[model samples]
Structure formats: structure tokens, C-alpha cells
Target: MDQYSVPAGPAAGEFRDRSSKFVAALYHVQDEAAALDAVAEQARIHNRCNHHCYAYRLGPGPDRWRANDDGEPSGTAGKPILGQIDKAGLSDILIVVSRYFGGTKLGTSGLINAYREAARLALEEVTVTQQLLLTGVRLAFGYALMTPVMSALSQLGLEMADQAFGERAEVLLELPESTASATVRELQAAIAGVYVEEVGDDFEVEGLTVLVTPTGD
Candidate 1:
């Protein structure tokens, strides 16, 4: 995919129903590791909360997603949060709803509604941006081709994520998947058609941070 939607940055919102408080937090995450970190950070800040339910959709597509109710009823908290994310047409994001039990049980449907609404509240406040679907590629070429390859990459506005120079030059790059073939063709033509190996299908792209909800609000 050349482009897809993602949150611009971290967002927060709260909803109260029948005294129960649901604080929804949404973050722009590049991978599952980042998602976990975001959740851990929330847990630290809101220690002793009733529950920390979360759902994440990572990458340009929907296949890389997971939901966890975190002790909430099955399909109650996490699924609803995920549903709201899908409804908003967002990806590469993690949305967590922390519950502070308000001395009254919300039951199944009420809990789902509260979590879903809280997530939507955060989504509404955050900015959305379209980003490229990145793909990792590794290229190794003879030392003689270094200058030309570097020149070509620079001219194409591509940056190497990692680079190694020895008897041979090896560089790892992340480029838009939609343009990978064309990029490879251009680079190969520049260096006289050398082999370029695709590293894997781990798409992680940089994201800009925008304030969705102010801290301590």
C-alpha cells in the first residue's frame, strides 16, 4: 500500500457512565513493541487502575492487529476499542481504555459502550495523517559501485537505515512498498544491475507527534 491513515500522535479522553470512569488513550505506534511500551507507560502513570484494556492495529493493513480486554468480559472492552479504530479507518495505532471502577458494575453492554465511546473521543481529538507502507531491503554491492549507488540513493531521496562498508558495501533501507520495484530498478540500473535482497515484511515508519489531548487535562 502506498498510503494509509494513522493517528498523528498520542491522544487521551475520558467518559463517565454511572460513576464508572473510562480513560481512553491513543498513540501512534510503528510496531507491536512500541504498542507494548505505550501501554506500560500508561500503567505506570495510572497504577492501581481497575483494568487496562487495549487494542492495536499496526501497519498499512488490518491483518496486523490484536485486542486485549485485560480482564474485561470477552469481546467487551478490547473488541469494541478495535471496532472503533476500524470505524475511524486508522492503522499503525494502539488505543487503550483504562477503567477505574466507580463502585458500580457497568455490566457487559455498558462496559462496551463506555470503552468504545472513550476511544472515539480520543480519536476525534487527534489528527490523522496518511503514511507510506514501508518495506525493508538490503543491498550489497562491490566497493567500486559505492559512489554511484550512494549518488543514486541520494538523488532518489532515500536514506539508508543501516550501512556497512568493508571490501563490499552493504546498506539496509526502508522504502515505500508501492514504489519498491521502481526504486530497485533505478538503483540496479545505476550500479549495473546488482542483486538487491528484500529483508522482510516489517513496516515501521516515522510519525509526527501532535497533541490530541493535553497532559494533566
Candidate 2:
């Protein structure tokens, strides 16, 4: 997926029922490592809390996530949190709910509702925005063509993906797949057909199919 929504910044919310408190914090994470780190930090912060149940969506896809119920039944805490996140149509984010038992055992259903509400509340306070995914293109061109080639990229607001200089300099760049056809046309018109091609496998982002071509035959 090219674009998806993530938390604008960090946000927090809570839900209380029968004195049991479920506090949730939201964060934007790029990968599993960051998601786990956020969970660890929450655990550290709420060291004395009963459980640190969490759910994270790691990629543009829904299958790239895990829900940990912590110690509240098998599917009580984590699944509800994850369900809430998915319901909000968000990914690449983590919602960690720290629970403090108030001497009242919120049964399976209670725990589920509490966690879901907590996560939903936290998400409601966040600012959602779209993020783009970019892929690399290894563009090899004659040194002489660098001027117009660079100018074309500059005008399109495209950025270099790599930095390597040589006689026939190779410049890697990234662009959204949605503009691939137009971009290819622009580059072709500027440099002729001598160089420029897709380099890697086609990928998806922002609900667009993207492919890269290399200059080499």
C-alpha cells in the first residue's frame, strides 16, 4: 500500500469501569521493532500495572499485526485493542493499554469492552494523515545528460534515492507509482531512449501499482 493513516503524534486516553482503569497510549511506528519498543517503554512506565496489553498494525496490510491479550483471558485485551485499531482504518501504529486492577476482576467481556473503548478513545484524539511509500530506481545516464535529468527530477519534486558518481553516473531515485507513466514520459523526452529503465519488482503503495525499470537491456 502506498498511503495509509497513522497517528499524527503521540496521544493518550483512558476508560474506567468499576474502578478498574484502562489507560492507552498511541504512537506512530514504522516496523515491528519500533512497535515492540513502544510496548516495552509502556511496560517500563507502568511497571506496577497489572498488564500491558497491546496491538499494533505494522504495515499497509492488516495481516502484519499481533494482538496480545496480556493476562486477561485468551482474547480479552489485545484482540479488542487490535479490532479498535482496524476499525479506525489505521496502520503503522501501536496502541498500548496499561491496566490497573481496582480489586475488581473485569470478566472476559468487561475486559474486552474496556480495552476497545480505551484504544478507541486514544485514536479519537489523534490527527490522522496519509503517508506515501516510495521505491528505488537506479537511473544510469551519461554524465552529459545530468543537467536536464536533474532538472526534470527537481521540477517534479523527486529526490535522489542514492549517491554514486562515475563516468556514466548512476542516480537512484524514488517516486510514487501513480505517476510512473507520466514520469517515464518526461524522462524519456528529456534524455531520449539511450538510458533509463525500471530496476526492481513492482510494488504497491497508496493503493497504486508501482514498477521500476532499469537502463540496462
**Which candidate gets the maximum TM-score versus the true structure?**
2
Weakest lDDT window of 10 consecutive positions for candidate 2: 200-209
Q: Which residues of candidate 2, in runs, are more than 4 Å off? A: 147-172, 193-217
lDDT of 1 by residue, 1-217 (tens): 5688888888899999998889988999988999999999888878879689999998765589999999899999999999999999998999988888889888999988999999999999999998765666677767666677778788778898788777766787777766765676666554543334431233211221111111110
lDDT of 2: 0.77
Question: What TM-score would you give candidate 2 relative to the actual structure?
Answer: 0.78
Candidate 1: stretches off by over 4 Å: 135-175, 186-217
Error of 1 at 159 (Å): 8.5
Residue-level lDDT for 1 in candidate 2: 47
TM-score of each: 0.71, 0.78
Per-residue error for 111 in candidate 1, Å, reads 0.9
Best by lDDT: 1
Clashes of each: 0, 12
Model 2 RMSD vs true structure: 6.9
